[model samples]
Target chain A: MTVQQNVAQATPTINLPTINLQGNHACALGAVAAGCRFYAGYPITPSSEVAERLAKELPKVGGVFLQMEDEIASIAATLGASMGGVKAMTATSGPGFSLKQENLGYGMKAEIPCVVVNVMRGGPSTGMPTRPAQGDLMQARWGTHGDHPVVALTPGSVEEIYQQTARAFALSEKLRIPVIVLFDESLGHLEETITLPDVTEYENTIRKWATGKPEDYKPYKADADGVPPMARPGDGYRVHTTGLIVAEGGFPTQKADVVAPVMKRLLDKIEINNDLVESFEDIDCQDAEVVVVALGIVGRSAKKAVRELRQQGIKAGLFRPITLWPFPTKSFRALTKKAKYFVVAEMNAGQLILEIGAAKVDKQSVSGLNRYDGEPISPSLIKQAVKEVLGHE
Target chain B: MTTSNKKNLEMRFSGAGGQGLQLCAKIFSKALIGEGYHVSMSQSYEPTSRGGLSRADIVASGDTPDYPLTTELDVLLILDQAAVNASEGIIRDDATVIIDPRRTKNPPQGNFKVIALPLSETAIKLGSERITNVVATGVIAALSHDIPLDIVEGALKSISPKKFLALNMDALHAGVELARGLKTA
Candidate 1:
């Protein structure tokens, strides 16, 4: 969710945590909003509603919805159709999302633009059918093996869920990369009153094409912004995409010279597009002695807890990363100068903590308030951890 | 700034799932927000979908209310016994507790005042089980005196569909009437 501090509006907006549309149907509408023409998600807990809704809604706009053989085919088919010059996506929970990792990496490697919605469930293996967790935040970044780039956004409201889904696809297509829209089980099943905006940006976004003369076009030719124009198979641009390292124009080559820059470009696109790829919300952290870092649904709990601590005259703040990858280093690094204590509160034992450790270790006191029993990490525990880290307890 | 009596009012509504209690909570919060006050709402429920502990707590003040206040509430609306018994100990001295007498036999403990009204039973008599939340909302409107009946009625149609909308509207009227009768008594 975008938190715009509108000083000029001057209406004294209430402190109510703004309401958003729920997660599952939000995914369906997001896909539609992002101009996705193909969806193939298998039924899974906390995420099945998305598939169920898309099955009913996809046809009205002439999009395709299929129940593929498995999660692998689910992504592969979506990727293939997306390469055919249509925006595509797949939705799944933990197990299925885990299953799609192999193809997900392939899609990243091939620079195939698409969106994947992981309606996260509590899991090492199907831990809970209807619960919320942030364990997968790290996994969403590193689940696929090898050097990969990821764009992830967590929605704390039903409205953000709907809008983020669309935004994820737009980023995927515009940057020619895959994006993971993270919504856990609790969010997927949540029912709320969401005001659907009549005007939205999803209607206008990048549409990959089979452009230029079929005979003269080099399929991988970099455009001014560095993304090469992609052409479909039957477009006669004579292009090929593979999981293996391929040379320029997508041909199998042994020379390092041919394969190196494709990898560089794939990684570079995420950097060039970092501003658009990232999203977050900040609380009163200025002059805060203790700053708590969190993501996904647990982030909401952090916001609540911070408010309570501040009331007691405790200088506690919440630093949340909406875009997990291309980590919010600038903000965190700057924060360490002012903040003395840092706490990482996520659902897993200590997954996202490693990143905080990487960002800054000796700079401040770092700790984790982790929960893995299929329950949400409450704010009181985080506040207690903050107090202890601050030497108040 | 003139602090209306609503500035100090905080409320908790508890009921079973499928009873539309959460929707009612949101509508009441929206109505209060329309009055230009601070409002925050949160709901807790299990996965059962039919019979479960579903509750929505709304905190409103001239300024922001402290984090999901748990110590003592200014007002408590309980649709069942579990709510009153669960929260009976925490309400502040002189705070008001409203319960659906049909659901709970035990009176509230502590220094808090208690009002046992069969709002749900009255709502059932008015025609449907769905209107129970709307009636409970009216009981709240009476106790807090923060939200207007017109605002709550408008919120009903805005949230529910056309088919069930009229029933909830009448349910709101019946709720306001019952509160008025209690006020005179």
Candidate 2:
């Protein structure tokens, strides 16, 4: 059968009801709230609920949901759907995430805006299908193999996943890049009560479509803000997108002068507007002698540890980076200067600590509490890390 | 995490699969949430979960819980000996332990306040063997006082599938009555 037959046919609309949901389901509904009309994914554990829910629900919104043969094709079809003018997304776990990296890079280089949800599971290669881990921190940034900006957001609670997934779409569309929403299996399988936000709460952001005559269009042209307005394939605008470095006209170019501007614009779109993408939560850092840096579910445990330490009259704080890719360097640098030491706690051996050390000048000032045995980093472990960092009980 | 008399409660419900332990956990969690408590519930099944070990836990508190996983279980509700073994290292010394005496003839040794009831036998006598979990939840709600029986009933009314709603409610009420008798028994 031809690939054309693989596309899903639209079905009748169904009511979107508010209910207590798992983080994976919340991610699917959140994407729908953010105007995702196309979902192409291959089911992977812990992340499978996202694909399963979208398959049944997308058609209700007059959207298309396609289950591809594999992870590579899943992302490819998603990119194709996005280029066809629909807001698209795909969800996967670690193994599938690794498969999608090449295309993730293609989506970045081609400036196709999309959202990729990684419901994180343990390990190198399908290590633990049902276990939770935050080992993909560096992989999300450097996984695609080259210097490219990545916008990765992690949500600790189910309710926060809804908000963050929607925000991921907004940031992807506004910046014309792929945004990754990381939810560990711990959060993905977690079921909790959440009050669904009204439509007004989540602000939607759509890319500026190219205007004027088709002949005047420069598909790779950068606006003053370094983001070029996008045009769909059938929108009467001649758009050329490729994995190769190209000029303003979107055709491949080998000349350094032409390549320099395109490369610079791609990086500048995110780095120059870093303020718009940087987000973090600071807890009790003012009087803290030691600050614990963490993200994902570890961040939640860290917050609890910080509060418990405070009750014991130990000055401890939590610095949680909601946006993982850009690193939240400037704000964390300022926050670090006030604290005597930093403790980086995550499920992986030590991924985010490198960034924490890089953000602050001294490497010795930062320590790491790592767990890779397939369990979440507990609060007491973080409390111990804090005590060790402070060299006190 | 609260410093008041209103404190967080850590609970675990474990049984052989097909006893509806997952639904029991859900009903209890929803009841607590309805009463304005933040509850995080997680369930895990062994590789042989269909006929083997199935366990669910809930962390309920007036304040939002930072860690969803239960560390030191304040209450342990076991329907079989496997559950007692599963909960060996987790229960606090002062924890309130509830078990199905039919399955656990001789209870494990602990410094806990033990409430041994015929959970499965009671449900089987009520004309259904599928609702031992709901009955156990009723006993739990009554004993813990963190979630009210009426609230759990309301949660059941909303969440339980219509066909089995009546049977589940009956089992739940039977459990509530059983736990109430323990007050005087």
Best by TM-score: 2
Q: After superposing the true interface residues, what Cα RMSD does each candidate give?
A: 5.5, 1.8
Off by over 4 Å in 2: A1-19, A198-203, B1-6, B16-18, B46-53, B80-90, B101-110, B124-129, B177-181
Quote model 2's TM-score.
0.90
Chain A TM-score, cand. 2: 0.93
- Among the numbered candidates, top DockQ falls to 2
Query: Whole-model Cα lDDT per candidate?
Result: 0.73, 0.82
DockQ of each: 0.13, 0.48
In terms of lDDT, the best-performing candidate is 2
Give the alpha carbon lDDT tens digit for every residue of A1-393 in model 2: 000111011222245343568888889988998899999999988799999999889999999999999999999998888888788999999999999999999999998889999998889898877678998988999999777878898887887788788878778888889999997988998876666654332344688899989999999888887899998676799877789998899789999998887888888789876866888888876557898888878888887888888889988888888888888888777766678888999999999988887788554488889999877888989999899878785
**Backbone collision tally, model 1:** 5
The TM-score of predicted model 1 comes to 0.78
**How do the residues B5-101 of candidate 2 rate in per-residue lDDT, one tens digit apiece?**
5588888888777678888888777887777666778766653436666688888776657777778899888887766676776788889889898
